[model samples]
Every structure is written in structure tokens, then in C-alpha cells.
Target chain A: MVSAMICLLKMPCAVVCSKIAKRGGAAWISTLAYSLAVYAGAPDVDQIFSARWAAGIDDGRSQLFELGWRPEARWRFNDGGRLTGRLRLRVQTESGTRPGNIENDSFAPATRPQTIGETGELDLRELYYERPLDDWYLTIGKQQVVWGKADGLKVLDVVNPQSFREFILEDFEQSRIPLWTFNAERSIDDWLGGDWTLQLLWIPDQTYHALPKQNATYAFSSPRLAPQPPPGVSALIRSSEKPDRLFADSDAGMRLSGFVSGWDVSINYLYQYDNRPALHQRFISGATPLVEITPRYHRMHVLGGTFSHAIGDWVIRGELGYFSGRYFLSNASQAQDGVASSPELSVVIGLDWSGVEDMFISVQWFESWLSDYRQGFTRPERDNSLSLLTRRYFWNDTLQAELLWIANTHDNDGLLRPSLSYELEDNLEVRAGLDIFYGKRAGLFGQFDNNDRFYISLRYGL
Target chain B: MKIQQLFGMGVLLMLICEAVWSTPLPDADEIARRINARDEGVAVARSLTMRLTDRRGKTRTRETRAFRKYYGKEKRTVIFYLKPANVRNTAFLTWDYPQADKDDDQWLYLPAMRKVRRISASDRGDYFLGTDLTYEDIKLETRVSMNDYRRKTTGEDEVDGHHCYLLESIPVDEDTARELGYGRVEQCVDSEIWMVRRSRFWDIKGKPLKTSYFRDIRKVQGIWTQHRIEVENHKSGHRTLFLFRDVDYEHGVSDDLFTQNALRRGL
Candidate 1:
């Protein structure tokens, strides 16, 4: 046992110390080093640590710079059970001014991003316990559950709320807010001449979208997302109304998946609050009129299904979702609350091809249609989006180049991301990329046109 | 005079019998059957180390633990990445059918995405994870396709001091050749051990593509196993080496381990 412990120390120490020494000084790296010390002290635990730092190029003003360190640990028991804990230590500088008075946006305080030392925050990302019991697998704790088959677009992947702080620039794994959930799954054999599985989820954490506050780096200031008051009118905005109770405001979902004839398919249903808030407005008529806007959360019903089939070198995937009781903000004259309830239908069809050696290409078409359309709504009756992604690996998988383009047909606005990453060593990587946006301000990607910049990041993991 | 004629006819018959007895080698089809019928155990579990070397001589290593089980005529395989922190806990599962016309099913579990994605199995010609060996090369190993290829015994050769028979195989059609990325392949099959000791592959354009050497052939649990393999690509000056260790065939894997759920559960 002593010799084994010595072997373990030598292994991680060589990897961690060498990487740290190469990267030199960084506060997050020091934190990671401290975490490693704790890891080395525990012999029965398995841990993973990584640090990343990204800085944006100059666009006339101070550019965005952020550093983060994440440490995850897993413990296994003799009874075939495992417990995992993960945390993130993040700090940001030159990211413009921070948002104020919106820290408690999520329903659960623990799930909210905890601010520290003005520009730093500590987040408990995930803590879960998983065990296999007879024929069922059970995982209960704060975790992130992903669904659907779409990429870069949400059709049925609404299980967890997301942070729009960077406007979809970050990976979903980092931006998604983990919720306290009870998840279970069971597999059935010889069911209808196919293999099938059923998964169930019960989430008590009613976290809402952590939207960017006003005046922040990636805040919503356009007319489409955030309407401006008329010159003669004044507006008063109130705090968002969120669900407070745990059991009463909980969310639940069920999914049944099956494989038949070389196709994988799943049907799902979720009953939960719409992460996007609906604006409830009241206009007063007087010499000086005032508009009162209140953000409120409403329950929604979502039914969706996804299917994927692989044919030769191509894989085709599709997802469809039907949403009811969802409200949309409108600018109609007769609107009482400045919003209208609309039933929405969303569909995504994607194809991934790997015909070329060392290259992958994927194209997707996403559409959302409102069954009950209203005039003067912020969005169109039928919103269409097309996305193309291509990735190629060179130098024996040590260097990678990728491009992702997403365009909205109605708004004619799109985002183009081109990035190149190289592996410096076994667990260290360096990447540089550009985020470019085009089109009018009323579009989704257009709102970030001025924020287009080049960025570089360094990542080290063990 | 009649007795002399009968004795001469008997001598001719004896000569013919002797010629037939001297030709003891089996045909290509019979040899393929014997190679496929070799007892490779009901289940196998092992750890693999793959080293990929570039033209610049930079080597990258990847470690994985794999399990394989045979269910009648079908085979199921699951591999979990054990090294490289970025890809750790990632798993791949494949269910291979015996019929040549049927396509196999494969699924990949990505830890970062926390999702199981179905991937195409027919892209067998594509390299697996930037390795010199293609997916077909790793999946089928030395097993030759009776439907896709036309095989014939070319001649005799010696590999690693062992007498071997040379078998040359060509894809039956243009489409098969294009799909396999191979115009022709010559295999050196050991006479005593029905396993390929060395193989050379040509590109679909009839250019010399790569050559693979199977080494360290030994018996584990009374079954012939190749513990090491090296492939050198001629077109591109790259090479890949695979080393398998701690092979176990006695402890059979559970049928449940072949399911997609097992991929998500991870190692």
C-alpha cells in the first residue's frame, strides 16, 4: 500500500508540476495547485483538475479577460455506488462593468453564481450520487441532464436553464446551470422486438435563465429583446417574479427511447416553467404616461421527440418539440400585458458527414413556428435558422481547425466562429479564434456585432 | 503380355495417387473458413496502449480498456478511454453482425457532452482517431471478408521464420473497393496457426498505401493471440503501434455490458 501511494504521488506530481511550471504565474493555477495537494492527501479518491484563461483582442476598448479553475473528485464505494463533486473558481477582468442587483436570478440560492471579491465567483457545479440497483440506475443530486439531438440550438434540451452572459459563446457544459434532480433509468429487453429504455426526472430547483443585466458586456440592448420607451414616456421595471417553493414549483419529465432497424429514437415530455420570462406591462394614461413592466414566470408544457439514423458515412438526426402556454412580448396597441400567449412548434433536422478523412461536417436547419401568431410581436411568425459546422484535425490529431456559422433567415443576422487549437502536450492546449457577427441590430446575432473580436485561450488539465 | 499391361496400368494409378497425396494444401475458401473458425474464446477483456508517431517522430499515447463478448454469431465490443484527461471516461460500443450485408450499430458516449450519440459504422475506411489503422483494420483484425473480396492462394512465403501461405485478395466491385479504400491486399497466413502474420494494403488507386505487421503471436488461455501490431503508412510517413496487455478470457463479460446503458455508466 505504501509503495502504491508513492507511485500515485509521483505520477500526478510530474504531470501537474511540469504544466504549472511552464504556464508560470496565475492565481487560478495556484488554486489548482492547492487542490492537487488535497488530492494527493487522499488515496482513495480520484480527481480531475483543469485551468483555463481567455482574453479577447482589442476592439478599441478594454477587452474581455477571464480565468477559471475547475476541480472534480469522485469517490467509489464497495457497494457499486459513486459520489462526485465539482466546483469552479472563476475571475474576470476588463470585461466591462458588472451587472447589479440580479445575482439571485435563479430559484435556488445554491444554484446561483456566487460573487466574490468584486470580479471573482465560486460555483458549486455538480454534486451527485449514482448507484445501480437491480434493473434500474439511480442518480440523485445537483447535476445537469442533457436531452435532444440538436447542436448549438435548443429544441427539447430544456431540462436545465442557461446563462446568457456570453451570448452563447461558451460551451453548454459551462453555461448550463445544474439543478437538484432525481434521475432514474431502466432498460428493457426484447420489448416489441427492440431494445428500449425509460428515463425519468424530477427537478425541484426552479432555476430561470441568468440573462445578462443592462450595461454588461453581453447585455440585451436591442429593440427586439429590450424595447426602449418613447421619448415622452417613462418606464418603471420591477424585479422578476420567480417560483419560491421547492415541491410545489418542481419540474418533472419522462422519456422513452428505443432502437429499431438501425435507428435510435426517443419521445419525451416535460412540465416546467419557461426559462424565458414574459413581460406583464401596464400603461397609465395621463399628462405624463408611465409604462410599468414586470417580468413573470409561467408554466409551460413541452412534448418532443428525437431520432437519429446513420447511413454509410452520414448520420441524420431530427428533433421536434411542441410547446404550449408560452408567452411572447408584443407591441400591439390593444395588448393588456404587452404579451400574447402562443403555442409554438420547433423542429430541427441535421446531417453529419465524415466522408473526408480527418474531417467532419454538419449542417442543420432549425425552425420555430407560432401556431397563434400576433401582429407587432418581437419575433416573426416563423423563425428559420441554418447552421453549418466543419472541423478538421491535422498533425495526428494534435492540431484542429473548426468553423461554425449560424444564420437566421428572417433577420438575416448570423454569427461566424473560426477557431484553431493545438495540443502543446498531453493535457495542455492552446487555442485562438475570432467571433464575428453581422446584420441589423434587431437580429439575435446582430446585437453582438460590435462585440466581434479575436481571442486566445490556454487550457491545462490533469 | 496382358499381365505386363495390367501391371503398367497399376503403376500409373499409383503415380496419380502419389501426386494427389503430395498436394496437401487447402484452397483459399477452406483456409478462410479455418481462420474464421479459430477459437478466440467466448469473452475477452484487456487493456490497450496505442502509440501514434508522426513524420516528425512525435509520439502520442492513448490508453483504453476494452471488453468483448460473443453472443452466438454476433459479437459485441465496448472500449473505455482510460488516459488523457480530456477524453477520460469516454466509451464506445459496437454490435457487429455476422451477415456481410447488414450494417453494424455503434454508439459513442462523450463525457463532456453527457450524451450517447449514434455514429456510422459503414465508414470503415476512415482512420480511427487519427491512427494509421482504419476502422475496418481494427474491427475485423485478420478476418477476411468472403462477400466483398475475391481471394486466391498466390504462393508460399516465410514470415518471422515460420512457413506461411501467401493469399492475395481483391475487392469484387468498384463500390466495394472504394468503400474499403483498398484495391488489393496480400496476407501472409501462417501454415500451422491460421492467423495472418503480415499484411500489405494498396490504395483504391492502386498505389502502395500501408503495411501491417502482427507480432508477438502466442497462446493465451489456449487461444492464439497477437499481442502487438505495427502499421506503417507508405503514402504518409506515419506509423501506429498497438500493444495489448493483461488479456483475460476466462471471466466472461455479462450480456448487459454490451448495452448502450453500459456506455453511459462508464468504467
Candidate 2:
């Protein structure tokens, strides 16, 4: 379907150029050259087909097959300035999994289409234009603005929202949702006597994260009250309202970075609305037993910094962020209760070593702490996690084996992902992997213990 | 009269002994310095194609563009991969200092990550992009330091129909030898051009590791350059052939091309 569309788009342009050439127009050649360059340098299209078959290791009865295909194309304009656009299309079909039961599921209604059955989605990943000035750079349009330099865990990488429909199983690049924004950066090496850069960003659109559907394979199965009451139940229904499309409702941030003494360092600040919604419950009357729940987004201010340095054969990296006025669930018993506000801090430290030939290893530790711990709250005051990644290359680097493990130290829950990938040829690759989860049912990874499965995928680039 | 005759005979014997041992051999340090100074160019740019063949006869070809510039005692080089969709847009940059005591700076840019990462100096011994050449091999031409190695003029030999000087270079210490992954290297340097025509490397265990042959010597912008180079790994039974498609010497290169931003931008 995409090929046909591309042909249709090119036919008219070609005919017009030929006509101009016959009319003896001097500008025809340059015009034709620009068009040809655009065509020749058109971004390569990628098509991936994947199939997953998995069964519960303990029961050996719960089995499922998920088949999917993703096709994406990028078009880069050669109009002198850097301008590019990308279109991605995905289609998936699943067998042997029943439809989700929304009553027991915690996911919002918007995420229902992504969890089961046959579905298709179309997205515009990037549609941006970039220009470099004398000592500054500017970019505008819809794009993904990444921040921080950590792996596995995010400390200050909160510029864009993410999709948890796959429960962190997908690559972060594929999960981060793009936003419409303007970005600029200025070089200050001449003034600062060192290599320094100042960056500013403004996001004008309001976007929310997409969570897993209720009763889905990767969804949380713990008990929870329904977000919306049934019809004719004498209840008040209030949904999370999106911010208005105004400059006052936008988000903004800035970052200053430089390299000093063989170390890369940066400091950043941001003010924005929280991506996740908080629940506020209330009762209208005592005699009628009326219940009301309002979903609202709170404001937050984040201050963060990052640093990386290489020592001997190891590269050490660290990131820290502090969030002020963050909202948390209240421990009050009454239905008419509001979320409490508190300050939170998050930190991550990592090390990468590649001393052995064709082998590389990376380990990271991450933690989060809330200020002024309060008793009886559902959320913990401290959370600690660890992650490890190891990769080995063989057959002249055409084949690679990788193992990834992430464990929550505070909860004793963990996930393991092991994969082997082989490059069949230039622009073509095949990969197979196993995803396993283990721990108590209440833990994060343990909640999806039944979702353990294996998968294989083939990707071909044009 | 008899004492005078004995002193005169001892003086004659001493003079004869001095004359027999006074034919001075070539200084190894001077020879090595001449080899380093032979190819002089302020800047260079070239496009090369590398073909790597394994023991099973499987071949993989890669294309790249490289640029180098000299600023005082510092040399900067940047290389960008141009072919093979998976590896395209990847770049490597290096800044080498003339001072032997200072370590070189190197950075790698990966297009997929959109980030530039610093590479440790200890990892230079690993193979470069699945080729028979290591990072150290590509950097060997610029790292001629007399303090790290001892050079000796062994003999004269003919290489590729040209009479050349046969020289052997060994690490100054055992630790240096182990760190270089090679105990010694033998080179056949052309007498007329002072450029290395062939080189053979031996591992620390005194086993032959690899041999590299340079061919198709030509002058570009008044500098002698080798258009073709071949390296064969004895242990792995793998061979690599580098063919320079285009070469230019003393070309004016912008300093901005050597920065991390240029590496991330690619060619």
C-alpha cells in the first residue's frame, strides 16, 4: 500500500519536470536535480514481521500466539535546511487470549484497543525542520526531545510521555511519544573558555501517557474500585480534563551542558504538568450514598543534573533529579479525600566496562526517595532497583547475544530478558528472545508472572 | 734501543685494532625518524573501500570517507562510514598529540543513539569493524615514539623489486610489550622513498600474528601515498584489502570537521 502511494506522489512531479525541460527553462535542471536528490536520498523503509508463542512455565496450559507487522517510512527534504518526516504503521493480531474484562482492569478506556484482538494504528513519529545558525541551532515541529544520559531507568528523561502498553518490553525509542515543540541551542565556547552549550525547549501540546488495559496479559490484577460508576447509580462522574490549547498551558525547560576535565556534565530545569493523573474522591450526600471520583493533573517543578566520566576501561555515569510539589495518594479513610503534595528525589548511577574482546557489560543502580515520610500511605517512602546488561559478539560481529536483568531490591521482584540476534545480510536481521518475570504477586514484575513468553522477529530495511 | 722498539710495536697494534672496528652502523633512532618524516602533508582526504574475507571465502565490503589535518604538533582525523545501511552514518574521530607522554583522545558517534561516546585508550587493541585491522593498526603510522620501542637496522633486502632497509622494532620493556599485544615488528622500508613496503608482526609468545603489504605507491600533491594495502591474520585465517578510491594531499580542511558535532552529523 505504501509503495503505491509513493508512486502516485512521484508521477506528477516527474511529468511536470519533463515538461519544463522541453520548454527550454534554465531553472529546470536545478529543479530536477533537487527533486532527484530528494528521491535518491529518501529514507529507507523498514518492514518488520514478528511472531510470539508463549505458555505459562508452571501450568503449561495458558498459551498464546501474537503476530504483528510494522511498516515505517521517512522522507527527508533536501531543500538546503534539515527537514524530515516519518510515518509509521502497525498492525497486530492475537490468538487464544480472551477479551479483557474492564471491570477488574485498571487501564483507562482509551487503551482498550491496544490490548487484544486485531488492531491497527498510524502515527507521525517526527515532522520537524532544523536549521543551524552562526552559533546557535533551532528546531521546530513535532519531535522527541531526549534528555539525560542514563540507561534502563529515567532520572531526568521526562521531556515526553511514554506508552506502557507493552510494559517496558519495547525499546524506549519506540515507546516515547513525540510532542509539538520548539527547541534551540547556542554554543558558548568562545565566551566560556570551554566547550559549552545552552538549550531551551517549549512544548505547546498536552499529552498523556498510555497505560496497559485492564485484564490484559501485562496488566496489574490487584483489586481496585471502578473509575466510573455504573449508570443510574446516583454518582458524579468526573474525568481528567486536558489542558487548554494556550501558551499559558504549555511546558518549558532549559539545559546547560559542557565538558570539563574529561567529564561530560549537564544541569537542567523544567516546569510542567504531571503526565500521570491523581484520583480525588468525594461523597455528595450521606443519605444517598453518592460517590464521586475526579481525575486531575498536578503541576511539578524538576531540577536535575547528569555527569559521565571514563576511568581506565570503565565509564561511570550518574544522574539525579528533584521534584517539588509532586502529588501522592492520601491515607485518609473518608471518600472525600484529596491527594497530598510532597517533594521527591531520584538518582541513578551506572558503570560500563568493555575490557574483554567482543564483550561488553553495564550495571546500574537506581533509587527514589520521598521527603518527610508519612505513615499509613500506600506508596513506599523509598524505592530501590538494579539493572544489568551484558552483550557478546561472535562470528565477526554478525551474531550477538545479550542478557538483561532488572530487579527491585525493595520488593524482591525482577525481570529477565535474554536474546540472540543475527544479521542475515546487510539491512536484514533476525532476533529471538525470552521474557521472564518472577516474585510475589504484589510486586511490580510479579504482577505479570503469567505473561512470561518467548518471541522472534525479522526486520528488513530497504 | 730495545725498550723504544717495544713501545713503537704496541702503538702500531693499537692503531690497527681501532681501524678494524670503526665502520659505524646506521643509527636505529635516525632511521625511524626518517621513516616518520618521509610522508609530509598538511592535510589529507580520501575515500576507501575495505573488503574483508574469512577463511570460508565469505567477503564483506565497507566504504568510508576519511579526513586528516595537522595543527602544530597535534593531528586530528575523522572517519565516516558511507555504505551498508546498518552501519552507515557512524563516525570516529581522534586527536593525536606529538608528546608521547600524553594519551590520544578518541570519540565514536552512533547514528541510532544520536550521541557521541568517548572510547578508552585501553580498548584500542580490538579489531576495528570486523576487519583484520585493529584500532592500533590504523593508528600505528602516527604513533612513532622512540621512547616506547627500540629499533635496530638488521640488514638490507629487496621488496617488490625495490632494495629496502630491513628493520626490527621491539618494545622497550616487557610491560610495554604486553600492552601492545606484540613482542616485535619487522618492516621492509623502501630505500628511495623511506616508506614501509611490508610489515610483519609477532605476538608476545613469539608467534607470527599478521603481515601487511603496501602497494601502488604514487605521488599526490607532492606526497608519496600508498593506494592499496592488504593485511592477513595468520591465526584467524582472515584477510582484508583496503583500496583507496580517491586521494588528495595538502587539502584545506576546516577545523570544525574534527569536532564531536561534525562526527554526529556524519557525511
Top candidate when judged by TM-score against the true structure:
1
CAPRI quality level assigned to candidate 2 from its DockQ score: acceptable
Interface RMSD of each: 2.0, 2.7
Give lDDT: candidate 1, residue A314: 92
Query: For residues A1-462, what per-residue lDDT tens digits would candidate 2 score against the true structure?
Result: 886787678778677656645544122432344364456566544454555455556666535554545443344445445655544445544422422322112222222123222444434455666777676777786777777777768888888877665667767766777777798888778888777888899987676665545445555442121243334456554655556555887889999888787787889998988766666667566656665756666778999999887676688888899988676665545323545667889999999897877778999999999895565344578989999999998777778999999998987988999999987765677888888988877677877787787767766554
lDDT of 2 by residue, B1-267 (tens): 699999999999989987887645466677788878776588888998988887888777778998888888688888898766567778988877778766677788876655677776556666777777776667665335566689998978888898888789998998677656678888888878888898888988999999988899888878888889999989888889999867887557777678776775565
Candidate 1: Cα lDDT at A251: 92
Off by over 4 Å in 1: A1-62, A97-103, A190-193, A232-237, A282-292, B1-25
What is candidate 1's TM-score against the reference?
0.88
Model 2's chain B TM-score? 0.88
TM-score values for chain B across all models: 0.89, 0.88
Best by lDDT: 1
User: Can you write out model 1's per-residue Cα lDDT over B195-225, one digit (the tens) per residue?
Assistant: 9999999999999999998999899999899
